[model samples]
Target: ARPCKIVEMSTSKTGKHGHAKVHMVGIDLFTGKKYEDICPSTHNMDVPNVKRVDYQLCNISEDGFLSLLLENGDMREDIKVPEDPSLANEIRSRFDNGDDMLLTVLAAMGDEAVIALKFNTK
Candidate 1:
């Protein structure tokens, strides 16, 4: 299942011969693409389970792979830094300054990405 974040939702009043309709606009969580769907209000829809994890920013490779410090003292290096230019620049500059940072990673449908960053509170 694809994970999406709903950004807009609207409902239409029931017609004389049909049930109410629901319109939804969502953004693809991983790709930043727009998706829209319309269906009867009573239809059953599957919702994807998304997970957010915060890991210590250990290192960033020249090729953009992120080394994340996991809670179990292990390192995760498979996730890459995002392609957004502004965010990527911010991350690289802050890390180069020796700041302790925490990366917020969002995961769904066996795919994961670095979505945000925060200063380490400790």
Candidate 2:
């Protein structure tokens, strides 16, 4: 992971029949690595309402939240240990569905929001 800052955001109608979309560009504040991603629509409000600085902080918070969740002992019980085949399949299916939804939302973020996220490696 690298520390980064959102430098710019832009949105445009994806296609005549498709929904609007947001594109974000970020620069690594520490190492100067740059990145770009399309934000889904659901994240649209996350950017503009929060602004660039706030958005970066929020991303850090989110990453922390995920890390904490993964570290918590309770999460170990949330899934079958030793990886039950059936349970693993079900979990994978659910994750795939969620990923699709996330992609859809990300692709729909309009220009007003800062869709870029910066992360620092531990």
Q: Where does model 2 exceed 4 Å of error? A: 14-18, 44-122
What TM value does model 2 have? 0.31
Model 2, position 21: C-alpha lDDT score: 81
Per-candidate RMSD vs. true structure?
1.4, 16.7
Indicate the residue-level lDDT of 85 in model 1: 81
lDDT of 1 at 91: 91
lDDT of 2 by residue, 11-122 (tens): 8766776677888788744235798888555463333222232111111121212111222233211111112355334434544454311100011222222232223223
Task: Write model 1 residue lDDT over 22-101, tens digit each, in one string.
Answer: 99999999888999999999999988888999999999998999999999999999999987787788999999999999
Residue pairs clashing in model 2 are 39-106, 40-105, 40-106, 40-107, 41-105, 41-108, 48-113
lDDT of candidate 1 at residue 27, scale 0 to 100: 95
Can you list the residue pairs that collide in candidate 1?
none
- C-alpha lDDT score of every prediction, in listed order: 0.93, 0.37
Query: Candidate 2 local accuracy as lDDT?
Result: 0.37
Model 1 scores a TM of 0.91
Off by over 4 Å in 1: none
